[model samples]
Target: MSMQLNRKYITIVFTVAIIAFPIIIGFFMLNKVVDPEEIMITKTEVSPELITIQGGFGDSISKYHGYNISHHDHSLFIQIKGSKFPIRGDKDFNISFTNTYGDIAEIYLVGQDNAKRKIWPQP
Candidate 1:
């Protein structure tokens, strides 16, 4: 009876150890450092002026108001041209992207300052 009991105890312990091993290793892997070059873009857009914009190009992001002065409705527009579109200090300003890569180029934006931005897309 004693030998059988010992055998059962050893079997149960080994089974538990086998089940727990991967779980423990997975927990440790959570601390592994993530690569900085990899960015998860939530939104995507295509424009001719953004052909050179690739993954990890955008440094930050800002929102711009639309046609209404009071409505404050805006869209996410990361400026790849190194210029601020919103503060052009005009009400009838139309943002234009022309004379570059066709209007079908995919690009990504990166948000650095508490903003949700995207990357230009992987080359």
Candidate 2:
């Protein structure tokens, strides 16, 4: 009888631990996934005249907004605000906008010139 009771106690403890472990892990994971702020923009237009960027993210320490332009495209416009560093062009020569919070967005442009043209016409 003593042996049976001990076995039952062990089984109960093990079952409770298994159930609690998963609940604890899931709680933390949900917090992490919900913590990151996200902003989405749809339908933006760019022309040679000016660049425009629009987005908002919560949290000052970890929030930013930017746009990405594709390689070798010159007809693209980019603008950003509230960023720690200046926007960088990608390897393909595309424009990229990033925020201070490490969020990045890109736009693809074509028929843009990245080449340096001569001021005077070639004779």
lDDT of each: 0.36, 0.35
| Tens digit of per-residue lDDT, candidate 1, span 1-123 | 999999999999999999999777744443322222333333344453532222221233322232111111222334322222323222222333332433343332323332323343434
Candidate maximizing lDDT: 1
Cα-based RMSD of candidate 1: 16.8
RMSD of each: 16.8, 15.7
Name model 1 segments beyond 4 Å from true.
Answer: 35-123
Each prediction's number of clashing residue pairs: 5, 10
For model 1, the local distance difference test gives: 0.36
lDDT of predicted model 2: 0.35
lDDT of 2 at 33: 17
Error of 2 at 98 (Å): 26
What is the number of residue pairs that collide in model 1? 5
Indicate which candidate wins on TM-score. 1
